[model samples]
Target: MASSQPNMERFLREWRQDALNKAQYESAIFIGDKLLAMTNDDNDAFFLAQVHFAAGNYTRAQALLAKQDLLTSNPSCRYLAAHCLIKQNNFVEALAILGEHTPTHLFATNAKRKTTRGVRAATARANSKTSSRHHDQGDDIPEEDILNRRYEASMCYLRGLCYAKQNAFDRAKEAYKDALRIDVQCFEAFSQLVKNSLMSPDEEDEFMQSLAFNSIRAPGDDPDMEDEPADYVQMLYQTQLSKYHNPQAFNTAIESLSTHYGLENNADILLAKADLLYTQCRFKDALAITESILMDDKYNFAVYPIHLACLYELRKTNVLFLIAHELADTHPDEPCTWLAVGVYYFTTGKIADARRYFSKASMMDANFGPAWIGFAHTFAAEGEHDQAVTAYSTAARLFTGTHLPQVFLGMQNHAMNNMTAAEEFLKTAYSLCKTDPLLLNEMGIVLYHQDRLKEAVKMFASALKIAAETDSDPHAWLGARTNLGHALRRLRKYDEALEEFDQVLRDGGKDAQIFCAKGLIYLDKERPEEAVQVLHEALAIHPQDPIATELLNKALEESAEAGDIGLLGTADAAFGGETSEEGGMSGDLASFEQRLGEKKFAARMKLARGRRTAAEMPGQSGGVKDKGKGVARSGRRGAVGGTRLFRGDQEGVDSMELSD
Candidate 1:
């Protein structure tokens, strides 16, 4: 019998590895069970339990581990048992098995190594003491740790999972932090903290610094540490966090991972690269990366949402509709599919349908944040500010990790003219993310409204600079340039402000607001003749724009008073020929006459000579259209340029018109 034992055990062990590798778990479990039944050896039982665990037979695996004396005498067995419970989603039972506390000292770090005899002896003594007190600190161990030194971090991580599942986010955040403290290489903990936005930017920075990376290192890393000033591993960890000012470092980190680890094509690395591009506001490039990833692995759901967002941001209505249709047909079960559908409806102007689909997407997966944000966005688009705020507020609470919800909240509040509330939410979001150009633009808008001209200019300039450096999407960052011009105009920097506004026109080609902005600069410069010309261009594009029309009247009055008839040539031939040095991107006065109707058009022309400029005002303040631009767009908050409702009501453009 003893002679047969060696051959039988060896055969079973070899067969176990092959079967497990093939995921032929049923056959492996059957064969392993037979061997265990015949021998009843502790080693056989342990080997069988692992097979059961791998097969997701958690109850049976736990039972097998418990049946052997190994459960009581071995830390590995106890950890395995706890893991089985966790796999079964019996988090409470899992926590009970894991215990409530980790020791003061960190342990089981750099487990990719053999343990020295001294380490084993010390662990044995500690185990003995732990056994005597009926206290087991080891829990849910990964098989990689040969001596299970990482059990302390593992315990905290598992507890965090339990707390998060139970909606105890505050406790979960702490538990996750503790896991990182215990093991600086504990990526699970770090990912949880970052993915959930559990820590504010400062808190994350402080936490990263506080990690004990140098406390324990593998032998191979000793030489590298001695030669290098910075910890290579720490730099790698930093790469996994939010991207920022140091583009070179970010590039180097990715290169190291790609070259040293040969993970260039790895899904995680690719996803990280795509995410960085998206954050940089380079949606098209990000979309391309995501597309390449999906081409290789169509089921890579991780990249789907970003792809949809890029499409939406680019206003690829046709592509979005086609993709939405396909996803609805082929990937109906995915929440992202419905989100795509919702976005399609949104872009196509079916607000009600968009709302329904967004709700459906959210209901499909409560944790899918974009759906919640989309649902809130539907309300915001329709001017349902209160409902939008409430929905965004809920999303903010539910997703404590993302700054998007807070951004939307601030925007909604700003739109409603709740300046204080807007500032508070924006500040909080700023603490979380300092580099998002859209967020910075929003901050600048609020400051502009608060009459903090200097601060607002600084914010706008920062936003424009960052956006310009990271992305070449002129349409995307045009708002920042326009807002900067607004601020510069307020600061009486006419030339600088005019240059900014001119740049917006040159880059984006034509924006009525940009023309109106230039008109404001001209007005500020007291060059009312030039202002009248630009304001004519603005009115040509948006005939009834309160700001454009009122500014035109103001310009005309000033021009008539100053007798600057360059733009107002001879009344008989005024606006008859092509406007030279008179109109800009709004085309010539002929097309303007065609669009604005000859009656109102003639009135404005007559008014340029200072004859009843106010009587023929283009549009009233209440008639201002929300073209999704404007600074004071919230009903009657007063248009951009002043409180004298452009009457033709002064067009109030809310500077906070963030496209994102």
Candidate 2:
């Protein structure tokens, strides 16, 4: 039997391999059952349970393990059963099995510890217990004084784990300290003490000293045993150091781990250090570490994800392409890696490539929300507004609590000239996520477009307040201020509006929108010269901006008619010194004269000004009365079929003229 044991082991391993590779859950479970019947070994039964667990046949695994009575007889089997119970979230059952196991059984001990922590965490959650109060209690001493003191210390350690899982750091630290006082060599208590201390900066030095002492005392120690504890302590130090914007501590922790343990023994520690760098936006350092890992072992697939993330963060387009190509070759079946590749293409303006990769990701993971969103964004970039909206709506339906699809839908509706729909989507989004300054700003812009100037002002003001409160990016605050200026200008608060625009420009926001908005305010004030100068400046920034182009032309025509040759010359010089004599408007004042028809223009201007003032001062009955008389005059012009200026559709006037 001993001579045949090697062959039997090989056969069992091969069978396990074949079982693991089965595609269908039913097929895998059937194979697992056959293997269980063929073998009486506890390890073999555990492997069979693992197959059933992986195949989502948890009920079958539980029944099989129960029939074998392995949950009590074999520690490994008990650990596997506990894990399956955890997967099913049967925390009580899992904890029961875990409590019966001994910590000297490494695999079972780890599982038991994890399950016990989870059970305690679930209990705390169900009772709505606060962490501070729940974790502070010492071990419940029995009334019988005959209980062993070592048993009490073990209980204290278990309680410490309960507190650790609840994130009650202070109490967990005290519990671990109590355990240490009872038994100084309790590795579990020492490990928990290190973890809890690192979470609080005030206890970091003490934890470090404890760790140093333990590492020195353990002779011929299993490197794996120290690996997890050391790595955990290092992770805590890295986290706490990150709060202070220090990246060097992460490197130092990695160095210490490498010096104490061989490189192969600390692969996870290296990976964790790289992850910390990535979190700090140090993509270059992360990439370097990942590359080093890859060079040492080309088959290290775990490093690929980190490498992809680092490349994407650094905007290393060339490296991203290389990584994607390599990942596609090596990991063709993994949807998440493909999705990362697709996102890279999407962000870098390669919509077609993005669509292809997103399609592949969707094929791999049909329920992937990001792939669907990316597909919709690709269509949106192509100006296929209807298709984009449909795709976005589908994505939105598939995933709840995601604001991206809603935001994109709002943008699509806005682009389609559907103000009402756009405003509705934006408002819904705002209600869902009130803290999102971007949503608030979008809603304000939509309100402004609908001629709800007062509401628009309020919305923009709300966004600005939120931005200030949250310390949002300067660009976002600047955009809100710019929009607020336009809303204020529409309300005829000219001075206040100008102040907002000035602030935006002072903040280095030289976008054409700001320039055109300022120019429009000047034009409304009948300061055509200033309007011309401002509009010319706007065109210099963005010559093809429709608003700026139209406003500039209007300013030039008005200036030429007023015999302001200096202004005309300034405009001509601004436009590459092409004077009106060279087939420009100076030689064709007749066209301008014919368009203006001064009498009608002056009457329209006066009526427009009165209407604007009346709109701004809503409750001023006397001013409204005067504006009503002007409207009556404007109405007579309409009745006489003259130009019907100051129409109720003044907001649509620009569109109508542009169409003509």
Candidate 3:
């Protein structure tokens, strides 16, 4: 009989790639089913179970593997069954399955190996077939030793994963180390270590570099294989870990992997690349890549949020709404899907709709930070400042690892005119995330308001430096430049201030605010002609801006005074006793305080200086008389009409008088 062994081996090889190629995967599934029917053996059953597990059909795989007899079936099949159980989140059952198979000498060699008289079996079966291949061969190594080692490594790796799932980090680390001791090339354990932040950046870089120089086989060994290819996900995960700490190394590593595997054909790798691009603010490129992925699989939830973000940044409002709706339909219960839709609504000024969607997301997952932030934004837009602060605080507490909540809190305070509070929050945020340019710019604004000109200049300079580094993000760079110009102008650095303003104008040539700042500097320097020109340009861009108009009037007055100026020989009008209310930054707060005091004075006089009157009644028999010289005369008391009178009598008469 022609055995189906070779075809089965090929099936396992292609199946293990897990490339997510529809045609290849379907083909492998068909071939595996055919092999299972033809052979109906333990190896065939195990292969089919693996095929199911790799395709994310964990329940079906677990059922088939549980049908095997524990005493005679291969131990690897039991281990794989445990893995499937873990994938299904049945950790207790998985641990039980793992307990049934120990990597002992008796267990490895006695269960499946044919025995003849126990001791006189000098020669093994001529060509005994096994489940898979192994590349490691040395005269000094015994076959049983290799088998036991592989079993031990596999056992420890799974145990570590279980502990990690249970959040037992220390125990997980020990278990991973045990796996590494048995099999030095266990990439899964190493990847987990890096993910858990147990390894430093240098150690991770060294580990990745070592992979290129060493001949490391993957966890499983194929006996017919001459060389094993690098696992695709492992390479991609490593690249992700390296991207933030060492971007150059990340690029180099990815380029090397692409040369070998051609990552363009893989969706997962494409997503990773797009994520890296997004982080670097190459939004347009990221959008293109993400859209391509969607073409193949529109239901890929992992890429949907990123695609939504790219569309929002590009101002593709219609496309953004269409995709957001599609995502909601695809994943109705997903918190991220709702968050994406809510953020889209928030961006387009549909605040009530945004709040409704954000509340839905928060209800779905109470711990979701972005949804809570969206809730805060809705409250802020509605002028409910206190509610906004509360929601933002909750998000900040829930997501302590990120700086976004604090940054937004600071911005909210700034908008409410709470400068000191805004500065404090921004300082804390900067301590947490030192490289954020937005925080730096806001801090500078606060300092400028406080008249800390020198320190404000430093803050703006730092923000500009950081913002300039992100060349792909033009808004950040432009905002920082404008802030720098304002700060320098305040410091009397006319030339430098003009240069900054000119740089912004050249970059866009449309910002009225930049032109306003330039005109202000020209006014300060007595360059009235130039000031008038730029101020008019600013008014043309933004008609009748208050600051621009004021500065332009001052410039025109200075020009007229310099040409045909005449000191007033006589006042055209005498000043009234009343002073005009103080205006501008120099006197606004003082004038407000004065107005507050005048209102308080009026209220106090109304309460303390009340008027009273006393009337004289000629028809009355008697009444109390006024004592003008601090002397009082008591009159006889008498009853007039069923009431006691203070000073009344039938015979004696007194007069009553009003006094002031």
Candidate 1 lowest-lDDT run of ten: 633-642
List all candidate RMSDs to the true structure: 12.5, 18.5, 24.7
lDDT of 2 by residue, 259-342 (tens): 544543445455555554433334577678878887778656445545555554455778777767777788888864675587
In the predicted model 3, the residue pairs found to clash are: 133-222, 133-223, 134-222, 134-223
lDDT of 2 at 456: 77
Regions of model 1 farther than 4 Å from truth: 39-43, 69-75, 107-146, 212-236, 259-261, 325-333, 356-366, 469-474, 543-547, 564-660
Deviation in angstroms for 418 in model 2? 3.5
**Model 3 over residues 1-660: C-alpha lDDT tens digits?**
367777866665466445335535556666777766766777767777777887888887888877755313555776688888898888777777666233333211112212111111102212433434332332236656666566566767787777666756567766765565455456677545543333333444544443321123334555432222323433454554422234454555466566655765477566656655544446688789979998998777556545655565566778868867877887888976886788677657677897898799778955444466567767665555678778767755543333445655765675466878878877776755565455566677667666677887798788667555643354425655666676677566879989988986776746666676777666555566798999999899999676577667876876676456442121121111322222122232224334544654565346324421111111110111211100000000000000000010000111111000
Once fitted onto the true fold, the runs of candidate 3 whose alpha carbons sit more than 4 angstroms away are: 1-235, 242-246, 362-376, 383-401, 416-434, 446-451, 565-660
Measured with C-alpha atoms, the lDDT of residue 204 in candidate 3 is 44
For each candidate, how many residue pairs have backbone atoms clashing (under 3 Å)? Answer: 20, 0, 4
